[model samples]
Target chain A: MLDFSLNKIFVEGNTDQKMIATILEIHYNISFPYNGLALEDCIINCNGWQGLFKQVALKEIYRIESSGKNLIIFDADNTSNLGGYTKRKKEIEVGFAELIKATKKNINYSIYLLPNDSDNGDLESFYMSCIKPDKRFFIECWNNLYGCLQSKNEARYELKIPKSAGMVYSYVDLFENYRTGFYQNKKTKRDYSDDGLWEYNFEENNHLKSLCKFLEDNLNLKSN
Target chain B: MPDQSEFITHFEVSNFKKFDHLVVNDIGQFNLITGDNNVGKTSLLEALSLNLKSNNDLVFKFHSLLCDQHIHHHAENKYSKNPIIPKFNYFNLLKNKEELPLTLVFNSQKVILTDIDYFRLKEEDKDLFVSTPYFMDGIEYKYWIRIDKSNVKPEIQFMYEDDYYREDRKFESKLYKPIVKFRNFYERDLNKFIKELSQIELLNLTAFDYEEIVSIIKIVIIPDIIAINIQKINNDSDEMIFIATKSSKGLFVNVTRFGDGVQKIIRYLIEVYYAKKNGFNYFLIDEIDTGIHFSRLKIFWKEFLMLATKLNIQIFATTHSQECIEAYAQALEELGMEEKGRLIEMEEHNGKVYASTLSYENIKAGLISNTNLRGA
Candidate 1:
């Protein structure tokens, strides 16, 4: 059973859980299971934004309150119908405040919206930003294809792929050694972090820096 | 809002088994309790049964039921040969073996139980004790055991309101009898089966009641079950329940030979029908989905809710199955009787038990989002 009474991280999906676990293991020396793919002991995948709030409403926040440190990570998901970063952060604040009041317990928790705390995007956007500078042309190529498809009729472009996911997967596919078949079927987009495909330079990338600092401040980890 | 006619609108338990202090408010007509192991789902039911009425016979019956459960749990292990001997301690009923009284409140009425050392009775009280026999005096007290050198036999004193109803005094209350059923798949005794059959027969169920029960059984369990009948093989033998199925070609199969699911359905429906006929408004079932198949859960819940509504009985049932919980939510929605049901989740935190009453909307949202509502 996953212990909720631990300094915990609640994310939006399995990809976010794995990605955050990978980043923590690489930079913070915090080891997680399954080569950082499975973090069931600590990181919880809430399935979606609504699920995160559902967990809060179910008194999961009270369980985390015992540990005294908690972190929630989700997408800003700025769409035509949905709210952006400010609105998402406000939702988290209101939810936590109401739960804290109802439960009568003060919880030390932080909300970090993806890609950065202020950005109107998702985990994939952060992954796109962390792509190697040399592999930027693959993302441009996918964007060009996406733009052409967008200009055509909706029926002609029936394959409605998400832009950020397409860009990140395209960049990672560049490292695929198809001729030798060495990394042919073994590597998936989920293994990008473990395969050392993405840049994790905290000094250079501000987004990665902000996330690392957020973890440092929130989690009770050994300082390097 | 809870119906004013409900038997118990609010319930609170303190210093009882596994609950330091727990309160469940807004008691609905049909309550499905879900929790992790040892979180006091069954304990809540036991607490409610203890205070369901002011009758001393009911109290003794509850104690015997607990003793039976304890004996059954241990009968398979080291006590298999000595199954008649009880290995459970009634003192363990108190939380942490403290002397604090077990307090239970049903709505505004409070029932407090305190264990008094039998040897501590005064000389004048000793005569009262001799004249006042324990409710189980006819049968051997299964839980009456001497512990340690002082001959410490625990005696229970029930205090309701401000009056103490000692063992000698008979409790007189107009409270309706609450039917309590536990999951006892091992109850294959011929006499007990006959007793249940006799009880159902005494209910004087009309043809319509029998038809409703048989149709529900057919819908939720065996589709071929045409009717249920009680038959005696000969004058020398006792009566037994038999199931007449469409495929049996007029042959009646003894109910004892049927599967556990069939037997459980028969037992449950009979109890509910008997309770309704007897003017009982409360029905408590522990492990309500014990023998029923997972696929039939939704229909069983639908029928259960419909019956409870029609009978105007409040039902408290405990379950550990997530499928059962989901089926209950689906049944409530399908019947549009969401307001009549509540999913109670009992959880223990910091050594104190708490019950969170989830409405239909809350339960639906949790199920849709795949939340761990059963505490798993």
Candidate 2:
């Protein structure tokens, strides 16, 4: 097993990681070793509704040398104050620039953040357009499951979930399931014979091609 | 041949575009303007181009496309409360030994000059002497001339306009014709300019059209490289594959397959060649480093200096690369232009754009550990 270097690619999830791995395998014929220091790695941390932003920040700067290239992809918050996000990026950059040398070679990290003022939606919309709209059935189901979690309802874990909901997650479960069972065809949907509900666990879809495709398209992995 | 005295001597615009004021103190044989992006550097060049076109009727074809320039006015009328109202004012370019005052206050929304807009000298009001010669040409080298025969000079003066076509209805008729009315002024050899313009070539690939220069390049086969066949379709705009590699390992990618640095270098080559061939005498390129690579900056500047000196094609370009300054210094030394070639640096101070010369000596000073060359 070639240990893939943890490059900190800033992609969506494990599904994206596997799809990228498959692409490298079939196209470049190189197998990626996950978390092995010799092989490059990219650990993607999210800046979504749940502010898990701190997770992607500090330690990942070192992973840049492990990967062939490191790219940080971020989406702007189109909420109200555009400058506020810029300030946030500036804060983080200033916070990070202090650590790295002011040269190109140190990290070779290029940050790409899409502007929020677009009349159209963000990268999610772009991903949705590439696949069927109802394909995010797993995300819908995950959010549905979180919406019902009693701990999520009483305005409890305000520090964890979105400002509105509070939910503590340990398994990185949302991303794992999002990668595996994002799409549902009639047959996959009809597999709800046990409880009239099809709950997809990440390890369960190890052989499904649709799961891989969903990850590749969403994370902008090299499809060739 | 027109007398040197009769030619447009000089011009300096104040409150024009990003330039609030510029003296242009002494016009040199060659001028090269280099600075960061959007620093009012191009704005100055555009002002000069506009001034030049206003003065000369040399080889400008914009006169033939008047209808196209005004079409935007009709489109703009959709949102504006006013119905395509035109505006005009004189910069009073010509000034006698005394100080010449120029203001950009809105004179009128009228389209044509209609004789009511001249400075109106009656041999009593006391002051009227302004000759600001400029050439304002849009991309593709389109230039136009602005003239007013009814002025106190009684004789008309044509100043060249740049980047944009003048929408003034009064000067529209004068856009055509040579410098000296029915007979052209300088008797510039058309064949000479055309011969120069034609020698230039480019990758010439347009997103919408695949039939340009890209269609004519002769393909060669090389060993060990994909047979050198390229597939450039509109469908694969986002997909960039390495088409060509180093000559040692010749690959087959389309011209667009290269990095922006190589692409811009190719583009600048075409422009330089075109300018050198035709006695364009002057070039104004904005955003000189939009897609240019720092590594290739030396080659680009060297090639430009060589061609500029050989063809006597004076150029003015805006750049955001400090490397460009270094290259300019080296280029000056290479072209033996240490004494000539004006290098002007522009800066935006408190919302206003101003310029100062980045002298050859100053460039030398900065090369040795100084970061504050702006002061120099």
Candidate 3:
């Protein structure tokens, strides 16, 4: 039913959708369609990366390109076995190159790998980069504690940067309940919510500039 | 009368072939069954066909299947006897007992095959039995048959408690015959079923508009086939042949000779067309993706979904191909029918077949994650 009349930004999952939606809203004051604000504008989270590679999604991308631009963002998922970041990113690009060319005559579309800086990381890495500077001290304390936990059990802290950053920005409730020391917290555990991080200083966040430009160009193209 | 519009929502097959007790539930309008080879996928389709109990066609079809397997075994071993026995191998019943009936239940309606009878001639009756001449000398065929031998018919009892039909109705009266006569509930239309199998010409069925027939077939078949029509060769009334014209060359070709893939496509199109036209409750197909190219499978499924949706007919198809299974998942999303499809994977655990019904969401997830739902 979504004929993609509105510029469609396809993401991997809800986390990416919500994060990008929040960014679009806070930075550019552009409310997403699913938020009961922008009925004619939104992000299309296809649930997982495979959905983007599916023929159904490919067909949808073509239809969306007819009247609007379609932006596809995927987690590089560049683990070590997949030949690391550069090769993995090239693989994805080459895989979709033919399909992209097939639809280019009728529609404009762009592919943006997550992290926006390198081809090797995921949305978690991007989220890590965009963490509010005000929470730096709490994050440092959390990292020190995570290091001690890792020294006790290395496997527990695998992929340290993303996981550590996740704890800082996502699990803010745990930090808020901390008593006096870093490891001392009340008997309370809560889910991660990305609501506050949307209002971070996007104007100075160089990591988000290309993505912002894509969204701005899409919006301008839609209005014209 | 069971609601003529109401289709089989679920089925439970017991003591049928390898399935001791296989129950498949949450059957949607479109279903793609996938599993390992010996997991009873074809048996599942046979069970559904038995539930329909359309006519004596199935009895003959089953006999042919058994005979083919038997003949192939002897043919493989040159030292085996030349006189091949033309006896119907007793149907496989649960616990290997002859009296145990193979039961097929479609919703609440049941078709039970009971009273096992095999045609065996007595010593005296054997003298009266004559060997029919084999016109082809290369193949030797021998069988025991008495001219006065009683037709060994399997006693099929259709038992249902639905009050919608007349209580005093005779099962014999509703028995499906080998002629094209439209009937509603409690009847199997064998001719209608055969018409679909032989690839019925769309022109013969006057119920459909000529333009509508061409358009639907165009979508159903390969892109090269631009149009379909029936040609009555030499003004002969019974000599109508299905024909298709290539888009680029305008060269017409007989539909049957157009390779298995095209024939399959045409067969499916005709089945859907007639099912809709005649208000058939269900369309049963085994290995729906057979002979279809992997790339064309998506096209086949997309067209199938469109036609089935238009007709409002429920389909039960079995497949072993992962491409076939994934095609359904892809079609559901493409057509925005994310909730209208279901994938049931059959498995054999401890010598008993069990069906694990997967919803569209589950199938999508399984496919994306590359999980082997098709079984080991």
> Which candidate leads the pack in lDDT?
1
Which of candidates 1 and 3 is the stronger one according to DockQ? 1
Candidate 3 per-residue lDDT over residues B271-328, each given as its tens digit:
5565555445677777777777898788678877887787777788877788988887
- Per-candidate DockQ values are 0.14, 0.01, 0.02
| Off by more than 4 A, model 3 | A1-224, B1-4, B53-97, B115-204, B207-210, B224-226, B232-241, B244-251, B275-279
Clashing residue pairs, backbone N/CA/C < 3 A, model 1? none
- Kindly provide the TM-score of model 3 when superposed on the true structure, using C-alpha atoms: 0.48
Candidate 2 lands at a TM-score of 0.35
Q: How good is the docking of model 1, as DockQ?
A: 0.14
Tens digits of per-residue lDDT for model 2 on B24-141? 4323444555544566665565454432222223223222222333411221242322222222212233323122332211111111112223334232111121221222333222
Looking at candidate 2, what is the lDDT of residue A194? Answer: 18
Candidate 1 residue B18 Cα shift, in angstroms, is: 2.4
Residues B115-193 of candidate 1: C-alpha lDDT, one tens digit per residue? 3343342233322433444443322222222222222553332211112123342222222234445635444543464
C-alpha TM-score for every candidate = 0.74, 0.35, 0.48
Scored by Cα lDDT, where does model 3 land? 0.54
Clashing pairs in 3: B1-B164, B1-B165
- TM-score (0 to 1) of chain B, per candidate? 0.74, 0.49, 0.65
Q: Compare the candidates by TM-score and give the number of the best one.
A: 1
